[model samples]
Target: MDDITIDRVLKSKDLLNLTDEELISLVEQYVPSQGCSGAAYGYLQIVSHICYFREHLQSKLMKIAIRPIIYLGINDHKEVLGFITGEYLIEKTYKPATEFGRDWIIGKLQLNETLLKDIFEEIVIEENIRF
Candidate 1:
C-alpha cells in the first residue's frame, strides 16, 4: 500500500461506515505479498488504523479483513502484535471489545508465546511502566 492510500484510510471519518466489500477491497489492496517488508510498514499503519477506528465492526468482518495479512511471514505478524501491544499498554486507547478483537487477531496469527512475552516486556521497559 502506498502512503497516499494509507493516509486516506487513516484520515477518513467514516471508516466503520464502509461496506464489507469496500473494507475487503481495501485490505486486498493494502496487504503486501510475502517477503515484502518494503510495504510492510505502510500496511501495518493501515491495519493499526483499521483496528483503532473500526473497532465496532463485527469480529467476522475484522477477521476477513485481517486474516490475509497474517500470511505475510512471522516477522510481520510479530510487528503487528508488537504495534497492538504498544497501543494497548502505552496508548491505552483500546476499549474492551477492541482489546478482545486485537487479542483474537493475535490468537489467529498463532504467534509464539515467547515472542509475545518478549514484546510485552520490551515495551514495558521502554515505557518504564510499573507492575
Candidate 2:
C-alpha cells in the first residue's frame, strides 16, 4: 500500500458501515494472491458469519449486533493483523491478518454510503430505546 492509501485508511470509518461488496473488494486487494488464501480467507468467513448472525441478533429479546475488531500479534511465526467479530476479543472471531490487511479493512469502510442498505439492513436499524 502507498502512503496516500495508508492515510485514507487511517481516516476511515468503522467496519459495520461498509457494504458487503466493498468489504469483498478490500479483502481481494489486501490478500491478492488466489494461491495463498490466508487473510482474505479469514475475512470472508468473518463477514459471512456476522451477516448470518445479524438476523438472530435482531430479536427484541436478544438485542445484539456483531462487528469486527482487529488484533495485532505474531501468528504462525509471522507478525499478523487480524479481524474478528464482536466488540471485544473472542476465540471464534479471531482471524489473523498480514501485510496490508489492516489498511484494506479500514479503507473499505471509509469509502462509505452512510449505511449498508442491502445485505446488512437489519444490522443498522436504529434502536428507539425510550427509557
Candidate 3:
C-alpha cells in the first residue's frame, strides 16, 4: 500500500487503542486549524454513522478482526470527492467466528460517544467546538 493507505491503517490502529478518556484528550489536543478539524470531523462522522446504523439495524455489535473503517468524501449534494480508509481493531477478545457489529467494534476503539457526537455537530456546521 501507498503512504496514505499506510497512514490510514496506522491511524485506525492508533484510534482503536485509545481509551474513552484518551480519545477525548486526543480530540481536545487538536481542533484549531482547518485541516485538523476537517479530518477530526470526518473521523467522528464515520463513527456516528456506524453507531447510528448499528442502532437502527438493531444489529448486535461485532468484534471482527482486521476490519477496515473506510470512508469517502461527499459533498452536500452527495458527490464523491475522495476516499479515506483506515484499519480498525478490537482489543477485547471475541468469539472465534462471529462477525461483530460496527457499534460494538468502534465503541471499544473510541474514547466516548458524547465527544464524537459534539465533534460531528461541529463538522455539520463547519465550525469549531465552543469551549
Candidate 4:
C-alpha cells in the first residue's frame, strides 16, 4: 500500500471513533436535500430527531474492526479510488455508494426529475457522460 493511501484510511478510521450521531450528521450534511424530501423550509414545526438502530448483532462490533485498504484502478481515462473497508462502517443510506451506486442515484433522482431522466436513458451513450 502507498504511504499516502494508508494515511487516508487511518484518518477515516478516526471518524469511526466518533459517536453515531456525529457520524450521521456528517453524512446528512452531504445529503440533506434527499432526506428533506423536497421540503426545503418549514413543514410544520414538529420537533424531530434522527435515530438509526443497527441490527442488534452488528451493533456490538467496533467500526474499526472492518478492514482498512484502498485500491487504485483505471476506468474511462480516470483513476478510480476505492476503499475496501469503508463498506461496513458507512451507514446504509450510503451502502449504495459503498458498494453499488444505484441507491445513490436513486436518492438524487428522487430529488430531481431532470437528473432521473438523464440516468434513465435507454442506452449507454457518450456525450451524456458527466465530468
Candidate 5:
C-alpha cells in the first residue's frame, strides 16, 4: 500500500483480498527476500510479496493453458516455445517477460500444485475474469 511498493502489485491490488493462509501458500517457494530499508519498507515488503505471489500464480495458470502447445514443441523449438509462452503471458497477465524479469518469473514456482490448480480454476472461470 505504500508508494514505494511495486506498481505491478498496485495494478492488481486484489491480492490483498486473499486470506493469510492463501498468501502463505503462494509465497512458500520464493527465493529469500532482498534487502530493503526505510520506515515504509515493511509495508512495501508485504505488498511486494503479494505481487510476487500473484505473478507466480499467473505463470502457473499460463503454463497449464499452454501445456499442450508447449509439449508439442518442447524438443524441437524450445526457444520458439519460450517466445510463445512469453506472448501468452503478456496477453493474459499484461506483464512482458522483460518487465517481469525472466529470472524472477522462472524462479520459485509454486509448490502446492493441486491447491494452485484449484485456486486458478476458481478464479479463471467465465464469471470471474476481472479485466
Candidate 6:
C-alpha cells in the first residue's frame, strides 16, 4: 500500500463506523504486502487505533488483523507479540485490553504452547505486583 492509502486508512475517523467485513477487507488488502516488519507495524497500528476507539473490539476483527502477522513468518511473531506484551507490562491502563489481543493472537497462531504459557504466567505475576 502506498503512503496515501495507509494514511487514508489509518487517519480515518470513520474507522469505527466501518462494518467488520470492511475492516477485515482493509486489513487483508493493505497489511500483507508490507512484508514482515512492515506488516507487524501495520498490524500494531491498527490495533492501537482500535484500542483507542474502545477498550474492546469484536474478536473477529482482532483475529482478522492478526492473520497476516502470523502468516508472514514466525520471527515476525516474536516482534509483534513482544511489542504487545511489552506494552501490557509497562502500561498500567492497558491491562486486560492487551490481554484480549494477546489471547486472540495466541489462539489463532500455531506457536509453542509452553512458551506462550510462560509469557502468560509472567504477565500474571506482573499484574499482581504492587508499587
Task: State the lDDT at 131 in candidate 3.
Answer: 24
For all candidates, the clash counts are 0, 1, 5, 0, 0, 0
Per-residue lDDT of 29-98 in model 4, one digit per residue for the tens? 3322333311111110000111112222121221111101110111221111112113222423322222
Residue range 31-125, candidate 5, lDDT tens digits: 22232112112222332335355564544434333323333333223332343434433454332333333333345322334543453444345
lDDT of 4 at 85: 18
Question: Candidate 6: worst 10 consecutive residues by lDDT?
Answer: 88-97
What lDDT tens digits, residue by residue, belong to model 2 across residues 1-131? 22323123324433345544454444344432233233334544433333332323212211111111111221211111222211112233234332233333344422322322222333333422121
- lDDT, candidate 3, 4-65, per-residue tens: 23124223544354444443343334232245324433343333333333343211111111
lDDT of each residue in 33-59, candidate 6, tens digit only: 456545545565565455445434434
- Which segments of model 3 are wrong by more than 4 Å? 1-10, 32-131
List clashing residue pairs in candidate 6.
Answer: none
Q: Pick out the ten consecutive residues of candidate 2 with the lowest summed lDDT.
A: 61-70
| lDDT of candidates 1 onward, in order | 0.45, 0.30, 0.30, 0.23, 0.37, 0.47
The regions of model 4 sitting more than 4 angstroms off are: 1-11, 32-96, 99-131
Q: Which 10 consecutive positions of candidate 5 have the poorest summed lDDT?
A: 35-44
Better of 4 and 6 by TM-score: 6
List TM-score per model, in order. Answer: 0.40, 0.23, 0.24, 0.20, 0.27, 0.43
Per residue, candidate 1 scores C-alpha lDDT tens digits across 57-113 of: 434333433333343433343554554445332453312123433554455423445
With candidate 1 superimposed using the best TM-score fit, by how many Å does residue 103's alpha carbon deviate from the native? Answer: 13
Question: Candidate 4: global Cα-lDDT?
Answer: 0.23
lDDT of 2: 0.30
TM-score sort, best first: 6, 1, 5, 3, 2, 4
Candidate 3 matches the true fold with a TM-score of 0.24
